[model samples]
Target: MTTALKLVIFDVDGTLVDSQGDIVAAMAHAFDRAGHPAPAREATLGIVGLSLDAAFPRLAPELPAEMHGAMVEWYKEAYVELRSRAGAAASSPLYPYALETLTALHAQPETLLGVATGKSRRGLDKLFEAHDLGRFFVTSQVADHHPSKPHPAMLRAALAETGVEAHDAVMIGDTTYDRDMALAAGVPFIGVSWGYHDADDLTGAAAILRDFRELPEVLTTIREAAA
Candidate 1:
């Protein structure tokens, strides 16, 4: 009998790449452009996994709700401006062993990789292209196509696209948003420690990883437990 496909869906920004500095900077720029105080760094980073519309309001609740859309637009422009500067990508480095971990997982015949990120399609594309990492994903669900994290739409679409059952898939990320989404979608979640949010913030995840190198073993453990 053919083995069931194992789908490992990943969160991009804080999980696969360390884009917090850029994200916070862009958010600060947006708030500044709106003539409001920039959110604290912790507050800005706290919303890493959420879509801009959902995140902006939380970051600047004092501002008028109608201004949230403009904030998002300003944030996009600021982020694009930041990315255009030389060394911006270098400053936002991927965590240790990120590519190695993905490469190891991709090597498995039964494993199919997917990305479910709050990043816009254009942003995700640039990231994949910059790192030459586009080949790793068999499917990708971005903010352009779905609601924010903690909503099961992206994961559901990924499962449908790959024909993988929820039980045969795992969501790997670094935030409570990812955990909640997986919980809602009936998929197991594995959290990573070295991201914007604290490891404790991911209490709802099935397992929280301290290192990128731990991912393969964690995935194996999850698969075995489900068996």
Candidate 2:
């Protein structure tokens, strides 16, 4: 019998690249341009996994919807401009062993890798290009294509694209948004502590990983347990 596919979906920003500095900077720039008080770094990081539409409003609830929309656009523009500058990519370093883990997983015959992230397709493309990492993912569900996380749309799309059942997939991320989304999708969820979200926030994950090297083993364990 053919072995069933095992799909591993990841959250990109905090999970793979340490892009929090650029993210925080862009958010602050947006708020300043919009003539609003910049949100604290903690508040900004707390919403990292959400799409701009869902995220901006949470950061500035008192603002009119129009202002939130403007802030979103400003944030995007600032982020893109920031990325275009020299040395900007260095601000977001890939976590240690992140590429190694992806390479190892991609080399496995039955393993398929995917990304479910709040990043726009353009942003994700830049990240992939910067690290030469696009080849590792078979599917990419980005903010431009799906509802904000804590919603299951991105995960569902990844599973559909891979022809992998929910039970056979694992979602690896660094936030409660990732955990809640996986739970809602009925996929196994693994939490990585080095991401933006606190370890305590990942209480619902099947396994909480402290190191990127622990990923393959965690995936194996989750698959076996599900089987």
Candidate 3:
């Protein structure tokens, strides 16, 4: 019997790349440019998987709604400047074992890789280009084109684009938003402990991975159980 294809979707921030330094810095710069205090580092990290519009409100609920748009633009500008100054690869290095795991999965003919990220398309493209990651993902759904994460829109779009059923797909991410998004889309979720969120908050994940090297075995387990 022919094996059914499996789709593996990854979240960019916190999961694939350790981008907290740049994220926190850009957020601070934006808040400073807006003449407001930056949110706490932990607070900013907590909202890592959300779109800028959704994220700014959570970080600064006291700000008038009208100011949020300008803040988003400021953050984007600061982020771009920081990436340019630090060099793309240095600003957002992939997590340990991430490249190896991606290579292994890409080699498996029955498995297809995709991305469902809170990063804008331009940001994701930059990271992919910097890391030579454009070849690994067959489909990439970005916040620029879809609703912020935890809404399931990105995952649903990935499923449609790849022609993979929800049950045959898995989402690997580091935040509660990722878990909830996968749940909303009826896809299995694997949480990574190394990301921005605390591991305890990743409740209800099918599995939690402390290292990316464990991903292949975990995927095998999920796939067999689904079969």
Q: Judging by lDDT against the true structure, name the best candidate.
A: 3
lDDT of each: 0.90, 0.90, 0.94
TM-score, one value per model: 0.97, 0.97, 0.99
Superposed model 1: Cα runs more than 4 Å off: none
Task: Tell me model 3's lDDT, rounded to 2 decimals.
Answer: 0.94
- Over 157-205, each residue of candidate 2 has an lDDT whose tens digit, in order, gives 9998989999999999999999999999999889999988899979878
Off by over 4 Å in 2: none
Q: Which residue pairs of candidate 3 clash?
A: none
Error of 1 at 2 (Å): 1.1
Per-residue CA lDDT of candidate 3, range 52-85, in tens?
9999999999999889889999999999999999
State the displacement of the C-alpha of residue 159, model 3, in Å, after optimal TM-score superposition.
0.4
**In candidate 3, how many Å is residue 204 off?**
0.7
Model 3 Cα shift for residue 89 (angstroms): 0.6
Give the winner by TM-score: 3
